[model samples]
Target: MQCSYFDAGLCRSCTLLDTPYAEQLTSKQARVEELLDAHSPEWLSPIASPEQGFRNKAKMVVGGTAAAPTLGILDGRGEGVDIRGCALHLAPIHDALPVLARFITLTGLQPYDVPSRRGDLKYVLVTANAEGELLVRFVVRSEDVVSRLRRHLAALQETLPNAVVVTANLLPEHKAVTEGEREIVLTSRDRLTMTLAGMRLELRPQSFFQTNTPVADQLYTQARTWVDELGPASVWDLYCGVGGFALACAAPGRAVLGVETSVDAVLSARATARREGLDDVRFEAGDATEAALQAQPGEHPDVVIVNPPRRGIGETLARWLDASGVQHVVYSSCNPVTLVRDLEWMPGFRMRRARALDMFPHTTHLEVVTLLERVDSPATDRPRVRMP
Candidate 1:
């Protein structure tokens, strides 16, 4: 992966240029193993994935002159460095960069200046599915540039017919989040839909989806296989963004409840279920920990699937699951440190299996899926084996 963009000092976002891809993967796998062995040995796995350009979404920082806009990492002093041809993005996105940049210039929308905070457009985030359909979201400082964005949308549609959905996110605040409280639809619809393993997933501008679509499909398929193999009577998907896990486990005569904090995500999940005619699966908007605690005793699920953020399952949620009658838990974590920490809190649960999915390549990050099963009963004294 010879990246001239980085050589020319145009982008420094990927700091792993000096390291080989194989070495990076090995180092990450070793780090994960060490963390799990020292903390939660049972969750350790030796498997790893090959490193490559696995990014599915691109969040470029817009800066420099609009006529010659730069898209890439911010400098040490906070200036956008051009990286339109980054190595981490998929080939399609990389191939489409020049045209996209031309469209941006043709539209005459000014790129937001972080220091001055004057421009209307902050960033242009583009998400592409496995099937090559693109969803474009323009993060703007305010709705003042609606006309500029509209003109840009028309040109983008003409220039890049593959762009399926386009929308404008109004972020008037000076916060770090690219999105704002309000979103204005610049296209025919306010949402973009993608299909994964025969299931449809609706994506809002702010909704969370795995950036790497190929590995994400593998992750979802693995989770589905595990759920089906367990054959649980009921399932509870906590932190179920857009019902990824819930929809994966949908089957006849099996009831699955998905709980998420995002109301829009829950609504999208429900819409997908309705479209698929999957009456057994439903989604609700609420804090996952609170939802789990409030679940009726009789309605307690036999299996629980939690894909929490980097913070991992907090102490409160861990305690709730410790007391709950749930028999199985499939934990998908992006942070190994937090995952091991949470596993230490629940000693009653024994690790059954684990696998590392390389979702973000060219970086140190790794996604781990762990299956933990509750011990039916406590047994008397036994020798404890030290972790390697």
Candidate 2:
């Protein structure tokens, strides 16, 4: 898992690259346990990910001149440090990066110069699905370079046949953002299919999907196993990006509803449900907190699945879930600090079981999923437990 970029100090994204992979996983699991030891829940063995060639997505900052473009992150001087062969990216992404760099040259798409803010292209975002299909996006300052990209799209596709979905995202501002509001499809196909845990999840241009394919599969499979064991009749997936958790939990008689703020993501989720013939599963585009608060009188779910961003659902949603009368909650969080804060908000619930999934290998970040059971009722009440 050696990275020349890390050694040369050109890119230090993987801060723990010096540490052994096994040690990294162990330290991450230990840190999570130390943070959640108060809950005293049963701890499942931590899931491990490959130290290298595991990242399915490559977010390379477009730099250098368009004629000789660099595909990687910007340096301290805001110039691109070429990492086309970064070890973290999957094979497809690693192979396609140089081709994409050439495409930039062919189209004469100027790399956005951060210091001067004079160029057109900002970033090249490439994603690879489990089937080896690719979705390529070019984030630019405006539509000024759209014509060039569209005109040469066929040649680029012919060279990179695996590129199924190609789009140009217009980020007109000079701000430091990944993408913008308007996404123009350069190819006939608009969505890329990610088959995870036996679910054909459609991915729109702006849709969210886990970067680590194998680890993401393990996460969904673990959640599905938990839901099956619990056998909840109805489940609500909050902040459901592309309905991964919701679709994973859907069953014969089970009703699953997924709520997300992104309309594109909601549309992708619904399409997946329809393609799978999941009549009982539905998706809505709205704020998760508002959707939860506006649930009909008899629409309370038996189980709720929340996979929030690093913020960990915030206090408002946490407090609402605390009093929602939901029997159980499956909480997946990427930040243990925020997760502990949210857990403190739900004093009436007890963490029954928890597991750590090393989705971001060679880094301090980790993903943890916990089963929270409402133990306020006498029938379900149990003494606080401790892990020996």
Candidate 3:
């Protein structure tokens, strides 16, 4: 997709924008195939993403005046760079940005000045699902603006009809984080539901959900398919964001436990489970590494699924999982560098199949999912199918 921002040299977030979309996917697939050669020969073609208008979430740093606030990235010298109609954001996010801009004027709120640090508004974060339902959060200096925003909440919500949830986050100190410690929900409903593969996954403002909603569904579906083939009696999902994988893989007799650090994500996951009548799956709030090591005797997982951060599972967790009795491991990684590092720790496990999902089309980012089986397991003895 052509972007005026790129033409004007205003934003180069999509570094690969100059390259053709087809070649971009090929490059991503080639990178993974080179790095994970011995790990998994069986492969699936990279699930390509749209050239533009695919991002489900839009985080625009609040800059300039509230009346004429800029919503985009900060410049090198810490100045607001306005990129309102960024092609990467989905239609709902693009449509709500102007409404949010207008709301700032109606509320008479002042956008924070990065240099003076005097204004109240700090950011405008908007997340949308496939159905175009939106969750809008205004990040501000403190709770002082919360009261003012509450008065104008109705008008804002009315202007942006798709906005199902609205919230305010406070950041008292000067920092790099876009969000703050305290979150105040301005709307009655705080959770947004994303329906994928016949399952509803609820996500809060603070919960982690993929920016590319369609590609995320494909990612979850492929992982669930692999888990179904293995048919493990008990499964553990580490860093389970809103229990997408855990809930999708939940079977009649199987028990699925999802461990995540975010209380909000775990709560949303639990609520969705109750709402969907999936009692076999449960989500808990805790550090994934600690939770994995602390599983009770009867609660041992037959298999473990890990979707670690870009750093991948650190040395400690990787070494622990290497010796853990879990027979199979499914790892979903956004960074191949860290993925290779973690793979070095797993001596007994061998990668069975690997696939790259092109979640970010015009960027270098790629999501690679791999299925691993213990060396001595009967499953590993089967001849691995070769990839094209």
What TM-score, to 2 decimals, does candidate 3 have?
Answer: 0.95
lDDT of 1: 0.77
Per-residue lDDT tens digits for candidate 1, residues 43-109, read 4343444344567788888777779987766787767788877767776677666777777788777
**lDDT per prediction?**
0.77, 0.90, 0.86
lDDT string for model 3 (194-255, tens) is 87767878888899988887788899999999999998888889999889889889999888
Clashing pairs in 1: none
How much RMSD separates candidate 3 from the native structure?
4.8
Specify the highest-lDDT model's number: 2
lDDT of 3: 0.86
TM-score of 1: 0.90
Maximum-TM-score candidate: 2
Question: Which of 1 and 2 is the better model by lDDT?
Answer: 2
Residue 6 lDDT (model 2): 93
Candidate 1, which segments miss by more than 4 Å at Cα?
A: 8-10, 38-53, 297-299, 376-388
Off by over 4 Å in 2: 297-299, 378-388
